[model samples]
Target: MAYSADGTRLFSCGTSKDGESYIVEWNESEGAVKRTYQGFHKRSLGVVQFDTTKNRYLAAGDDFSIKFWDMDNVQLLTAIDGDGGLQASPRIRFNKEGSLLAVSGNENVIKVMANSDGLRLLHTFENVSSESSKPAINSLAAAAAATSAAADRSANVVSIQAMNGDARNMVDVKPVITEESNDKSKIWKLTEVSEPSQCRSLRLPENLRVAKISRLIFTNSGNAILALASNAIHLLWKWQRNERNATGKATASLPPQQWQPASGILMTNDAAENNPEEAVPCFALSKNDSYVMSASGGKISLFNMMTFKTMATFMPPPPAATFLAFHPQDNNIIAIGMDDSTIQIYNVRVDEVKSKLKGHSKRITGLAFSNVLNVLVSSGADAQLCVWNTDGWEKQRSKVLPLPQGRPNTAPSDTRVQFHQDQAHFLVVHETQLAIYETTKLECMKQWPVRESSAPITHATFSCDSQLVYASFMDATICVFSSANLRLRCRVNPSAYLPASLSNSNVHPLVIAAHPQEPNMFAVGLSDGGVHIFEPVESEGKWGVAPPAENGSANGAVATPSVGASASEQPQR
Candidate 1:
């Protein structure tokens, strides 16, 4: 046992009557043990020494090795030496500066070690078996006996040789007490580390916090993520070459690429004004994915996807652009929906507004082009869907969307319509319901309404293979359904995955994007500027099997019919 320099706390290490070894810290003022350190050694310990220089380290010796510890964390740092390396009466001592240590386990042999790091042997003297002195065979034999007797026992217990009246044992040497033992000195300590209230405050950097994530989309190759923040874009790239492994699978040897402050053009059109409310700004990707166009601040800016640099800026006449869509066959053609209930056809190659067509009676909320049917579909706040011919720009058919039955009518701003991979059918997300419709007849094929008790839908998307449908809710919950039958697959609760800084924040998934190549991968943008990626874990081929929470589900995510699922399907929470 040893008292700290301040004498307020004591560090002790020794063997119990049962031969169980222990190391502990004692708070003398309260007359109670402060902490017990376990799982470092197995045999009884020699005297514990405190480093006077830093007062943040402690070290001790068992029969065969020296153990170093960090007083700050009260945890073992390292243990060094060989079997029966220090025979009989192992004693440890440190120099004035505590940078060097002297340890003796045998009368004839002494070890000089460096304490700069974990105790490293610097020099060895004529200790026991050294050639310069007569080998003390008895001491070596006794140490071997003690070690062999404690086989498979606790490692924290240092094997102490039974007293046999032999001076060759460690009991022969005595610890030399320092002059500081009798002298009192001023104490310097930090809170929780020093006694007598001699505490100091420390300066630390500000903690990082989550920002609101406005939109999320996958790059054309599905190898990267474009996290559209309120005013910037954060890129998360999963780079992979054409290389494959022995199993003929793409080798995932490279870590994903990420940016710190994101790209240089951190400011976007939304930066023009500060709007605290949550809204999905209009953005479009060209057919070839070479460029991205964003509509905000009463104008539209075209950006090169690879460079993220503005290529051109267009100020729409009068009404601001609210939604945008690129023609599926031509990268130069763009269809911009405006607040004036009109669709403006623009030819970027010629830098001109080819034409303007009026159909919707209200502002357009969503627009999508169908390459298979060669037509354009647009939805508006009037709860109407209109189909138009691409060649002549004429309205063909229109249908009224069903009103939100169980919740508030959010169709005006929240309505979303997307075409499936086959382009023969489409999915419409409006209010609290998600419905699949046939593009030919524009009739509803299937529908799933959110439970009234659950949060409203914020964003939804299909899996890469179009076999699964995912819907993100305002509560940070996600429900996956089988696209074929519309039956619930499983529900996901991502709030658990939020960083500690965002755990309690009023955040939820605002948008979701699926990986184009990896069916098991997807990214969800949170209401706060945070992105949660659901990636496939190669070890188990299944998602995390967390402790049951909602209802009785085993995991909190929407993936698939787990290709390796052996357990029963997770129930709804």
Candidate 2:
């Protein structure tokens, strides 16, 4: 069941008592049936959804076919046969704009269709099963059963239930039956019976099992799609838009939009067994888009983005590598945060670790490098922040920040520390609060409570113009804040990009990487292992507003310094 966009009407579908399936529309305010459409599906109804966009249509999927109806007149528009086998209860969802629909069921296929023009078949994604060994095991079991039956005596067959039920009520005597001998005068007694049990055993493969998409959603822009399976999330970018006909209507001849898989997150049971609380795999693209750094299993893989080839691999000692960052101006220099509360500085060109900075007593959680200030900052589980002078490759300062009271002391709650694109300011996010600091002063300028819940902040970044700060939380929201006064700007609920039902499911943003050049464009990495590049539609006068005076204090303002300042100068207190 679903409510219409205006909340004036309601739509629902189900099988009737007489075995007939139907879709009914109801007036929400009056609680009266507005219209009833019946006899559209031969079998039981699977799913029903109302298009909320200008294309006011209703879609219903059943065992064998999907039917489209015009919501205004209650007329059948068209019906498409299911390409795969029976889909008794297929999961269906519409994109945010109601332009496309996705359908999936027990089969290894997901069908994408156009909703505007007669429900045309757009694309079919097949062989998306999570467990590859299931098919082979089924075939092997069938073959084993076929061969095992041939060795059993047909006449000696007896139902186990019949024997067990009646034998307990009978006397302890064996009944005898006679078979005629060749002479006809003599007879042979046959009283013995034999039963053979069939034994079949199968050994499951030890490798990682493939998972099918159990849930799917589109970003609000409809430019990205996310597929969530068992322990992995697959992310794809819509490479093209649907073409329109001469009359400005979407046509069937237009080929399906191309989708490119950007990245995937795979968290297997084994990886979880090792730590039970393993962090999700994360990737970060360099400022120039030349190198891509990915962290998995305590190893960092460096890849050339243009060629998509592995350039080098760096393995940290003891604990796993959790976070990574590249120097804004020099891609060759990479900073890695390790599980053992140490930061390793590596020169990718030389393929060697240049230095290790240790200050925190717990695992390192965040790392960031500022090209303008030539400084590196790191945070760890011990609630301590360590600042390093990149010029001399030495630790400059260490500060122990107060941790939130009554929280467990297992892992570091700090998630990020990032420099603004303009190099004027930096942000340190710990627990639910974000602290903004000036580069020259290195003092906390403004502290804002970023989230209402205790969910830790996962990622934070400044817009390319350095006027706004974007922070993502574990509660599946990206909060936008004004850089000057740290005032709340807006909250972006990514789930709003999905269908109403699926939006309620648990999906959190894990990693966020800003685009090098575009201020409004950035890539968001989800907990399911999906990386989506978001280019939101701009509204009028929405960008770069000055912070409110009531929220900004006099001490929070810092003057920008000239580029020629000496590195040996002490930072202003």
Candidate 3:
């Protein structure tokens, strides 16, 4: 079941005992069926979702096809039957703004469709699971064969030479004969290996053949999609908008047949469990959409999104990685804060631990790497903050920032550390207050008290020019501050821009990412899985705020002072 953007309608799909599947729309408040779109799928219906963007359509999938329905009129808008056969209920997810829809199931392929172009197939990813497995399997086979042959030949020749006089001379003669015999046996082995192929066929493992997609999620920026399958997590990107058809309508055209594996992380233990019903392992994407993270059996793995390379694997004692941070300037360096009260500085290029920092006695809660100051800071539950110099990968300073007056025994909440983009200062945000520190002296410059609220501040980032800072409170409000004096510039509530149905929901902001190049532009991800891109509009020396646009675009019009425009102006998203 899925709720509409405004929460007024609910879309659901289910199969009856007789194998008939149906999709229905319900009026949430009245508890009545608004519309019933029946007999759309021949087999059991497995997936149903509502497109919350301007498209306002409902997509359902079954064994044979995927169907899209207009939410307002209950009309069958389009049905796509070219998906071949979905092994299980197809998993469908929309991009942050609902412009692109990604569908995957038992098959090893993910189909990306464009909503603006009548749900046309924009890109297809094939062999998402087997691409990496193939090479690993072949290498394992070659290594095993080499080891077995070497061991067997060594034993056989030793026995043969042992029975003769002067065993050393016999051993030398055995090699000459074995060399000749090897040449003859090579052809026999090749022919023997191929003989069965002429009469029989090779079959793939059942699990590999039916590796179904268990989870699908889009990054906050809508630049990539994370598909969690049975044995691995697949990162997919390279999205191209659909071309306009002859009728002047955007439609799916044949996309370039070229598709590359963005990156794949192996879940060896999870796959070895061999349970088809088990859930996919837990994984996360970094706030900036630059790194992919996954944890299994107390080990954390990081992958570079751009190159699709495994950046590093960290095995910290006792506690696992609870927080991660990538260096803004040097992608090769990453800081991982573990629950064990230690921070691991990893050099991704060599896949080695550059340093292990220890200062706090309890778990580490937050980590931040400053590009301008070349410093790494970590916060811990032990009421301590540790600062490290990135140049030497050594701890430079440590400060005991204890919990507030009465909350000393409470479990430490997440600590947000951010550096101003202009390299002037940095901020450390704790439970109910934040402190600004000068970059040069690393001295506390000013301390600002955060408004008391049930929801804490989930994210805080400085603007590019270092003039303004934006902090997102879980209460669905973003507080802007003047960087110099930490003065409250304004507080903007994102709920006002959300649909009416979602206003009542606890749709609080989870993350806020500022653009690296554009100071006025930033992105906010909500707890309800929605990403909003905002850009402060500059007009007549005043900042004009505009309504949030689909796909984060401003639509070429700006409103009066409020916040910013949309993600359309930022290059990263």
Against the reference, the lDDT scores of all candidates come to: 0.56, 0.50, 0.50
What lDDT tens digits, residue by residue, belong to model 1 across residues 1-573? Answer: 454544345665544434455567766434355787654445444322223224555666654676656665556665555234474325676664554455665555654443222121111221332444323443443333333333324442232211121111121112333333222112211111112111111111112233666666776544455655655443434444334422121123333445323455442553334342433367876533466788653468887766667788886435777788888656678898887889999998789988898988877878888765677888887777888888898888889877646534543655778887656788787645677888768888877665555567787887766777767777665555566645554555443455455545667778887766455556677776656666433553322232222332332333333211111223211
- Model 3: per-residue lDDT, tens digit, 470-494? 7777566666666666545455554
Q: What is residue 374's positional error in candidate 3, in angstroms? A: 4.2
| Candidate number achieving the greatest lDDT relative to the actual structure | 1
In model 3, what is the error at residue 218, expressed in angstroms?
A: 12
Off by over 4 Å in 1: 1-210, 232-255, 259-267, 270-280, 406-411, 499-504, 539-573
Error of 1 at 20 (Å): 84
Query: For candidate 1, what is the TM-score?
Result: 0.54
Could you give candidate 2's per-residue lDDT for residues 32-79 as a string of tens digits? 568987446564543333333333666666656556666775767555
Name the Cα RMSD for model 2. Answer: 29.8
TM-score of each: 0.54, 0.48, 0.45
Cα-lDDT of candidate 3: 0.50
- When superposed on Cα atoms, how far off is each prediction in RMSD? 26.2, 29.8, 29.3
